[model samples]
Target: MTTPFVHPYLPNSAPEVRAEMLAAVGAESVEEFYADIPAALRLTGDLDLPEPLVAEADLSRHVRGILGKNRTRLSFLGAGTYHHHVPAVVDEVIGRSEFLTAYAGEPYEDHGRFQALFEYASLLAELLEVEVVNVPTYDSLQATATALSMAVRATGRTRILVASDVRADVLSKVEDFIRPYASLEHVPTVDGIADVAAVTALLGDDVAAVWVSTPSATGAVETAMTQLAEATHAVGGLLVAQTDPIGLGVLTPPAAQGADITCGDIQSLGIHAWFGGGHAGFVGVADDPRLVMEMPHRLFGLASTSVEGEYGFGDVAWDRTAFAHREEGKEWVGTAAALWGIAAGVYLALMGPQGMVELGETLLARTAYARKVLTALPGVSEADGAVHLREFVLHLPRPAAEVVEELRAKEIEAGVVLGEHELLVCVTEMTTQADIDLLARELGAVLGTATDATTHTPVLEEVAR
Candidate 1:
């Protein structure tokens, strides 16, 4: 088998770190770290097995004995972590020499050379239609923190308001990080969307920024940007949007809705399922160049003069001014190489603008179909006629936690419950008709068994003394 490319700081460095760690523990090495007078605590030699290493063919049989015990299942889980269908071309392109190999040997003296990696950030800026772009942070949570920090300082306000229906993970992050210096408020939602009147009532002079999650965690579509943006603008407060990137294909962009700071996870754009935890986000703005001026993460930029050396003439040349500003431009070198190579080069080439648009439409349609199918199941409940983005919530007969465990026992990975009995199910382009049917079937069985058992037993409600 071919050797997979290993990250520099993995098990390779574990052995070296162990040596120093053992010494600090008053021992010579790992063996000495646990070296006591008890011989029973230590093994004398290697495992009692064959002396010589077996051939590759024989080794495969040995490994299959252990791996065959566990069964792999279809996943329905999509609270924040989703399972996306990654194209084969993505893996192929990212594994190329230009991306996989270390370019540390390349001389920094050739600073003027516009490499392909740098061009990647430029293309992202074009896709987002923004003045600047940065793909530096590892995930969306970090990006949110960084964006909030920049917005607060830029507007010089100490209050931040977040929509009540924002992802719980993001809410906890904001509370923990911003609690030290700022006041945070949660604006309630009307029906499934944000309450525009409540937001307007809360808006005041002290408010620094207002954050909103379009197509909220409940999976309801909230096209409240027009009113929300206006409310924020009235008080000199900035509007920040947390959106799903795929939804932008059809829905109005936050920038078009007059948002001052637009940022969200770009994981839907050709990212893999396995990379969910580390998939980063992008922040875009329309009017504020200062938002990108001192961003926490880095971004790449290009240089183009009106005319070559036109600003320089005779003894009053401004050559130094160009270089001075050039060094401060944004760039992310290593991690972004794969995103550029695969998404821009291959995915775009294969699927033109119309194809990408169609993909987004299909995802929305599929989500709608899945929601109807789930709602039609026995002992299941949901909103009557609410439009969903790509996921929806359901109330089940049994406790949400018990239902989740039952689904897992049958080799099915289901969604998480936000409240005591409510679970959110997400359907993406990857969810086939068969996958949806299996989920419906499994859910019906579990709910029926739970319902019958509960009815036969005596009900006891706890009463307060």
Candidate 2:
């Protein structure tokens, strides 16, 4: 019997099939179709592509086998994403068809989703100590860009001053989004925090907003936030703070610290680190009607039902969303991460105010202990030279990537590589004293000096009590 007309993996790509397609398109060759293009632009070689899988494949099992090859190393690596523990309940709720099915912002279709997102926003408002909170804007990084856009639009200015210490990738994304609409200037940092003196000097009338971060990229809590807010206010610029909602438990919420606007990721609450996604972004402001109207996403508010006492949720100021007015809407993220927003609401509802506070404290104590254990190695210096929280930057003598590679050999994913000698390390509730010790011991071995067992402090015992 003749072999079926097929490519190894793409079954429809046999030579005979290609010929028929070419004939239908009135072309002798694939190259002949684009023959009008200049010779210099045309490729001179076959495309370098991966070899297709064998046709005799149990596709699902094969895919799983390939996926299973991925090593589940003990991780200390949180630069762009985190490794917070997700309660089984979060997934149990998010996985249900109702929450997962409602991506469109259709209040009529799924009233429960709207109410859940409303609860999420309300919870965020309470946590940040701000009056307004948006559901989600793509992700935390894009939410930051959206927040800055709001500041620039609100002030009617054409320039933005972003802190140099904001995550490099987030900064780049914000710069890309805002370049056509406004000019960007970066304020330098010293010791992993925004330099207050430098920030104050750069504020001017043309500046729309000054963007700063708390527990900044290096994991050091930004101490100059209040002063920066004041300086920005003095020059008629709003202070936009990018923060982690989890950090607000042990640290001051941005609103309380004089920020005019606050934006951040709420992944640490109960969202799993499914790589760079499944986390929601939030934009918040004080109780200002003008600011409320400027928010780019949907807003849900509670109202009294027909009974006059019972409450029901409904759209608050939704004319601002793209759905209400497509051509002249705030921004179109109507279908993006809407489910994650609902999931976040479930997380907040499950955790409650006291749970959030306790989680924050646990992270603080645990991270502090981890830092003490890791930084004890000779020649290791902390890059973030302030009150580091949750995450920290360590400067080692050897290249970070190389050290991390050596650690990975022992099934330990040490941290993120920031530079040749810099590693960005993160510690969360999931990170234990034994985990910290393993990282230190392996890191020390990689650095050419094994840690002395007797001298190594008992981090778990010391912190647990």
Using all chains and alpha carbons, the TM-scores for the candidates as numbered come to 0.72, 0.83
Q: What is the alpha-carbon lDDT for the whole of candidate 1?
A: 0.64
lDDT of 1 by residue, 1-465 (tens): 023333444554455565576667777644553556588866666678774434666667778977887654577667666666657776686666655564333324323222443444444444455555454355566556656766787788888887638887877776787675577788878777878898989988888888887667787777788788899899988888777666655666677777777676656656665524536666666535566554644433445446775221111112212223465433222343334333433444454457667877887888888888887877788843457877788888779999999888877776777678888888887777667766777777788732223222111122224
Each model's total of backbone clashes = 4, 0
lDDT score for residue 80 of model 2: 58
Q: Please give the distance, in angstroms, between residue 17's alpha carbon in candidate 1 and its true position after superposition.
A: 24
Top-TM-score candidate index: 2
lDDT for each residue of candidate 2 in 3-69, tens digit (9 for 90 to 100)? 4436465665777887788889888777776668999997777579766455556666778898988
User: Model 1: runs farther than 4 Å from truth?
Assistant: 1-72, 103-119, 304-350, 383-385, 449-465
Worst 10 residues of 1 by lDDT: 311-320
